[model samples]
Target: MAVGLLFLVCAGAVLYSAEAQDPYSELPDYYKRGVDLALEQLNSHAGVHHHFRFLRSLDKSDIESGFGVRYLYHHFYLKPTRCAKGTTESNPQTCPFRNDRPLMDCAVCYKAAEDQIEPSPKPYVHCIQKPRLTQDMRTARTDHCKKMTYNSGAPTLLAVSTG
Candidate 1:
């Protein structure tokens, strides 16, 4: 009985120690408080009423710059909800028309290859999804790739950079 009790205590201590290593907890108290306030404000002001959980924060670093301002980025995602009428197809353009506030923008990336290349194969397609913003231009670029690649005399079957 003593041995079992001691094992349980050791296990509990290990678990506690593992959880105590939170990186967020190491952040400054003021920064943590600011994050909390920002989350609260977003939840309150957003049209949808749901728990907005913190996703992460990122900083954009430029290589050709000196010790400039260090920008911190934060992101959040909404908890799953029962209001699943048409949330999957929500976008900025269609959301307003459907009288719904979009939770996020939908971004799509496509990849394609030529049809007759024996080694390259045919009907090569790929897709990626990203959050869309007001400035995103959703232009179909299949023809653009074909034209651009045709001039270089090389296989233009790859993912094109968007910038």
Candidate 2:
């Protein structure tokens, strides 16, 4: 009885650890799809040179926009990879992260619905570059991005946006 109990405990612990390591695994299929589409959009932006990989999700929200439509919002962090933009030789998964470039904090908002005849709504992509790696600098940048309003102007090192 004791041996069986020990085995069950070990199995449970292992499963819990696996879940903790990949928070994305718990997200719904639609959410995962949204993240992939958002990442692709982020990479295609002219301001982005090197490829970036998803680091972690900062925030997310799902809102019912009346009828069958729903709005999805995802805010996440991205780290630059060694691969250059539009590089056919390497992908984000295989490319190692580059320490030289600044980190990106991005937010994507889009609409989702079933049996929709109209074209999908254009996604809103906004990314803020965090050049400094210091803890205080990161906090300040995060705070600044949270407060700043979205802009549709030309891209800069400090901000990149697409609609």
Candidate 3:
């Protein structure tokens, strides 16, 4: 029975770690706009059938490049939404997340300066698709997509650790 107890302890620790890794949900609008800009670039380049929504930020940093120029670096997660790509509905917030699709780990960096031109240079964005979602990601999806339900027709996928 000691082995069984140890297994339970280990499982609890793993769950806690996942929860602890989640970033803050209450971010300022300035940071959220950064996420939107990243999404715009990501959706444009991605070949995926569905558009991805910003799930949560993993980390962020603001560094002054020079002479009043600030560089914003954002690392975040993106989850596939029910809305199809190139749809007339421009708002990803209205679309529900698809549990069947893979989660995306993404990072974007861009210059933010008050004197910058109207159309700032495209942010440098890179993303990798993770085959499975972490516990924290699932929790975030649930909270973020609370306004809509998951697609019933899509097959429910399980989250397996790649590690």
Q: What TM-score do all the candidates reach, one by one?
A: 0.30, 0.54, 0.54
**Best model per lDDT:** 2
Q: What is the C-alpha lDDT of each candidate?
A: 0.32, 0.61, 0.60
The digit string of per-residue lDDT tens for model 1 on 1-115 reads 9999999999999999996554445544423433444444444554544333222333111111123311111222222233332343442112212223334322211121221
lDDT of 1 at 84: 34
Model 3 agreement with the true structure over 1-163: per-residue lDDT tens digits: 9999999999999999886542323565546666777677777775767877778877665544456655455667888888888882854466777998778887555556653411454455566686554667645543332322123442211111111
Q: Candidate 2 clashing pairs?
A: none
> Stretches of candidate 1 above 4 Å error?
16-26, 29-34, 55-70, 75-163
> Mind sharing the TM-score for model 2?
0.54
lDDT of 2 by residue, 66-87 (tens): 5676555667777888888788
The CA lDDT at 155 in model 1 is 41
- Model 2, residue 14: distance off in Å is 6.2
